[model samples]
Target: MKSFDVAIIGSGPSGASAAFELSKSGISTVIIEKETLPRYKTCGGGLVFRGLKMMPFDISSVVEKEFYAIDTYFSQKHPCITTRRKEPIVSMVMRDAFDNLIVEKARNNGVTLLQNHKVVDITFGETQTIHTTEGDVTAKFIIAADGALSPIAKIAGWKETRTIIPALEYEVEVPAADFERLSNDARFDIDAIPYGYGWCFPKKNHLSIGVAVVIKTNKKINLKEYYAAYLKRLGITEILKEEGHGFVIPVAPRTDFFVQKNVFLTGDSAGLADPLVAEGISNSILSGIQAAEAIIESQLDPEKAAVLYTEKLKTGILPEIEKAKVLSYHFYSKKSFRNIILMKYGQYAAEALTDLFMGERTYPKDYLKSITKKIKDAIFF
Candidate 1:
């Protein structure tokens, strides 16, 4: 059995970031991943400015597209508002390429990378033992970055209250002639659907379109139907690919406690995803850094480590997630959303919402009010 200072489970952004930070701190860290390197992950492929800034290394090579404009529609109307940023606020990249880039950077920083290793069980004691497909390994601390459906958390006896929203996305090859019409202003569109919203993000050669809706009343809706309706609205008759990929985005609030004994939970495993936008990358990366900081601090004072970890998470990440819970409920509610749109905050709402999403501003009540006042001023004056 190999022994280390830290054992991080999963190689997504959270795991890689944690390992990178730990190794940079001169701690012996090993990152265990179930899949091979550069594995494909289903995502909307949107990375906001805040998330890009949190990366430990440069990611210019993997960026697929940069967006400066935002188009938001309440229902198809004459005055579909547009908001433009001076610089690109969002960049699109394939998940496989983005995640692999971080993992490679972690390895370069001296973190041992164990690929194709699935952690079957974890035993916590004075020293933690992680049993994996590769072999048994012991470490002083364990970090779980295994995502929303984390088996590690379950095995470790941590209860998670999950409110999962199902998302379906497809990549379509748009004909050259139709490119201009499909991407008029290089802005992504958010169509307010029945229970959720549909998004259209333009890529280099393809259009990434998707819909997300909450599962309600123990009922299952056909994701295919929702995706097809989005395409039909865009006047797309033929799809190059007949099928699309599906994934789950957790909209739940953060868990009660992020650390217990010798174990720490970061990223989706701790339900750090933004509730309003269903975005996880930014929070994942931020939480991963926080986890590493806690681990390093704990090495100095093991008695106060868990308390400090919880405090940092509460102050840094949980507050934003709490606000997102309220905002998500407001946006997801049909009546509230309609009232909000009627108030004319739709144009810059997405960008403002993205700002809050990236933890740049927690709860943009003031910004929303300013937007509402601006709209009122324009209408009267």
Candidate 2:
């Protein structure tokens, strides 16, 4: 058995981020990836500025587009609102390239990279054994960053604790006219699908367009139908692909995503996507960092490590997720999202959201203070 200080499963944002940080900290870590590096990954491919700010190194080579404004629609084009900022709030990149950037960085930092390795089973104890097709690896700590529907998390008996929702996306090729026309702006349309939303993220040559919905939330509406309608709304008739790729995304961050037990869950495996936007890359990266910190601080004491990791989670990501949960139903209900969140505060809210994308503000960090002051001002002024 090959023994290491730490073992990470899956090489997406979370796993790669953890490996990168651990190596930088001089911790011995190895990442066991199920597939080869630079593989294609299904995503909206929008790297929010907040996510970008978390990167220690520059990825300008992978960035396809940087937009200064985000255009949102309630329905079709009616009541369309545009939020503009002084700087680009979101940058676009293909997942294959984006993930490769982080993974390569970790490799360069002295982290061992094992590709084409699928984890079949994991034996947990003081020393964890990860049995893979390639071989078995033993480590004092394990980080499960495999993604939603994570095999590692399920084998670890975490299947029932996390709830996953369905998400679908596409790399659509349209006519030159349409591609050029739509490429100028990025669009986020709410109610594009029942209990969900749709987006159009323009790339170098095509627009990655799709719709997503919370699983089991709306039984009557079909996501495919919504996706077709969304394309029609955008006048993208020349779809190069017949059927888009479909996957499950966790809608809310799991309260127990960080359950210690000498194993930690990061990224979608931990259900860390935003409840409102379903944006996850940023939080997952941050969780990866926090998990590394906890592991170093506890230094192989499983019981103590679990407690400290849980505490770190509660303060770091859990609070943001909790606040988002409260805001979810209300924000998505009866168009209250527009009335309460966007309208009540108006440009101020827009700026705040822009700040959110810029990593200037994080959920629940300044969430309570901002809301309390807004309420006071609404009543008295």
Candidate 3:
């Protein structure tokens, strides 16, 4: 049996990031992955600037493309809102290459990688004995960095508390003309679906186009219908090749404890994706860093690590997620109100969102009140 101080499940950004930080701190760490390296992960693959800024090492080799300007379209009545920055607002990457780079970096720092090992069960006590298809591995601490449908979280006794939203993405290779026309910038089209949005991210040779329903609904949403409409809207024709992938995004955090019995939940397992944009990469990486740091600061004491991790989240990532949740409610639920706010302050809102994506500013604490006061002042003046 292999043994380590920490064992991380899933080689996604979250797990690999935790291993990177833990190994760098001289802690014994092992990464357990179900799939082989360079495996395809279903994501829109658009890394916002905030996520890019969090990387400890250069990722130029994996970066497919970068965009300094982004456009957000509402409808014909409202003009498209564009935001520009000197630095790239978003960088494109295929997850297979991107994730493998992080795992390789961690391996260089003495982290063990056990690929093709799917965890089936975990026995918890002073330490955890993880049962995988290949063999058994034990660790003093376990970090669940698996994706939204985290079996580890379920095995650890967590009930469903997150708001999981549906999204469909396509890796499309259009004809030369179509690719040229759509490849210059990334864009978001609000109202492309009933209560959701559509995005187009240009990559090195293809386009990662996706549409997501950001809110929960009782009625059925035909995402395929919406995606077809979106493609027509974008003037795409004569596709040389295309592939479709469907996935869910957990926009809300778990209401229960983040740490249970020495097992730590990070990334999608903890439901830490951004509420407004449904961006998971930035928060996932951030939470993994915090988890590793918490364990390191606690000197591997499970109790202290749990308390410290919760405290760090409350002070840092959790608060920002709370603020973004409020903004998301208004942005999606209140259509008329949102339209009014956007019509009057569209440019300002776009710039502010850009700042948030760039890691330059956080969501305002009093976001609702702040916007209300601005609208009131505008009306009076």
Best by lDDT: 3
Q: Which regions of candidate 1 fall more than 4 Å away from where they truly are?
A: 183-192, 214-219, 300-303, 340-343, 348-351, 357-360, 365-381
- lDDT by residue (tens digit), candidate 3, 1-381: 999999999899999999999988899999999999989999999899999999999999999999999999965469999999999999999999999999999999999999999999999999899999999999999999999999999998889998899999999999988989999999999888877899999999999998999877787989999999999989985778999999999998998889997889999989999989999999899999999999999999999999999999999889998888888888887887788777788899899999999999998888789888877776776
Per-residue lDDT of candidate 2, residues 55-145 (tens digit): 9999999999999888877554356777887767889999999988998999999999899989999888888899999999999899989
Write down the lDDT of every candidate, Cα atoms only.
0.76, 0.80, 0.92
Model 3, stretches more than 4 Å misplaced?
A: 377-381
Give me the overall lDDT of model 1.
0.76
Q: Order of candidates by TM-score, top first? A: 3, 2, 1
lDDT of 1 by residue, 1-381 (tens): 899988899888888888888878899999998999899887878887788888767798999888876666555652556656665667888889988888888888889888889999888888889999989999888889998788988888887676777888887776666665776544333444555778887777787888887423256667788777877777777655533788888777544677776788888888888777777898888888888898788773545767777888888777777766765665556554344554555545655665653446667545446545765675776
TM-score to native of every candidate shown:
0.89, 0.91, 0.98
Error of 3 at 340 (Å): 1.0
lDDT of 1 at 52: 82
Error of 1 at 43 (Å): 0.7
* Candidate 3: C-alpha lDDT: 0.92
